[model samples]
Target: MSAFDPVLSADTVDQILHLYATRGDDHYGEDVSQREHAEQCAYHARIDGADDALIIAALLHDIGHLLHKFGEDAADRGIDTRHERIGSGWLARCLPPSVSEPIALHVAAKRYLATINPSYLKGLSAASLQSFLLQGGLMDAEEMTAFLAHPAHQAALDLRRYDELGKIVGADMPAFDSYAPMIRALIMKDAR
Candidate 1:
């Protein structure tokens, strides 16, 4: 996918929102709805000073879950139908690497975190744990070694952090509007 193709336009965001609004009711686990989760991710990314692409990535990361119709069983089956891969591919058609790569890497980040932080693994659901192994098992020592060689490691790490914190359930969750300007600024800057 060309970097320019994946750049989120107003229509793209609208399509995403509509997709979530219609399907958000079918959530599998956790009290937070999909829309709520996206908002939380975007909010946290902004708070962490993430670039616009990263913020958009956070907001749209899990959209695959809604888009692909995967259930907890499929997610747990270690099936290649993992939402990250699916979502990243879909996003790649419309957005740039700045957005798509992190979404693509977020699942790997989950595995990476699971390997390094025992506590992180402990917090995962049984399905998530199984899927983690199927997805790559902390990416293997060799893969991890190679992954760490990249400059984007820190950005991927930060995206992972936002991914985790974004799942909280509560009325107190931050709003998405607050981060819209930042997202716009980032996209505009990238366009330049």
Candidate 2:
């Protein structure tokens, strides 16, 4: 069954989240469930004073990881899975570009981060580093200038940071339902 309809009602959001109730980045070496990571990212975004839109984006950023039936170790098997694009495309139907844009661009943001700062590469977790290599190591010279100018560049980078930070295990935070108001309101007023 589809977790969401043409428009995202609150109930559908919960159904979508159910995909996370059972799994997350476990095979990728993260200790948190998908639900926890989403909650953590949203919580951090809220604390960082992001507006409701970005917070909702953060909360739902990795929902693609849940929707696909990829093996937990898909990256290990050399499958990129392209969760960013999948999640963003699925979300674009119900979310504004303010949210879906960041979700779509975050992986590119990681590649962008690696190009600008070598130290940033050092900070990536094992699985992240592995996927980074698969996604594209560093942007080439011409790509560098263009990537820097992308309008979604900054939001993608910010979401990437939250994506990494949200993986910490065993944290207590509000559940998915806690953001229902934001989720309900921030969805595209006109469904795409």
Candidate 3:
């Protein structure tokens, strides 16, 4: 398939799974592959008792990185791929706002946390820190205020935390296919 064919064609659960199975091995500068990071994030969300949508949001948050033409080291090259927007935009077509909005806002959530909690920046992984800088570093006062006003801001923050918790080099994680049932159910419900 072409570079973006998978992303452009993936509007259903099966296709989305295929996208991951095909492209998830690229680690995107992190210690874990995209699939591993996604599984770990979902695991963290579930352990924290997040709702279904939030869990799915956590699992798929960085999907845009796979969908883009930019190589995995876009951040290293000082280009912000804006994976949040691309991933969220794609998911919005199949899921409700409950999932997509948080994915969209998660980067902003990171920026917000960095601005409000100095210690938060210290916990970020090297790849995250690089992307964080490319993603506009810290939020200013007005940006923080605006971010706070978004209805899904809290969930976004939660997803951001999970995102950071993922990326363990060799953590045991469930297979990516395990989420297929939940994703299929969500797609079916949203189609109704």
Q: Pick the candidate with the highest lDDT.
A: 3
Instruction: Give one digit per residue, the lDDT tens place, for model 1 in 27-105.
Output: 5345677778788888898889887888888987887887775573565455656787778787666566788778877
**TM-score for every candidate vs. truth?**
0.79, 0.87, 0.92
Candidate-wise lDDT, in order: 0.71, 0.77, 0.87
lDDT tens per residue, model 2, 95-152:
6778888888888888888888999999988878999988878888887777678887
Show the colliding residue pairs in model 2: none
C-alpha lDDT (0 to 100) for residue 51 of candidate 2: 74
- How many clashes in each structure? 5, 0, 0
Q: How do these models rank on lDDT, best leading?
A: 3, 2, 1
Candidate 2 Cα outliers beyond 4 Å, as residue runs: 1-14, 22-28, 188-192
TM-score winner: 3
In candidate 3, which residue ranges exceed 4 Å CA deviation?
Answer: 1-11
lDDT of 2: 0.77
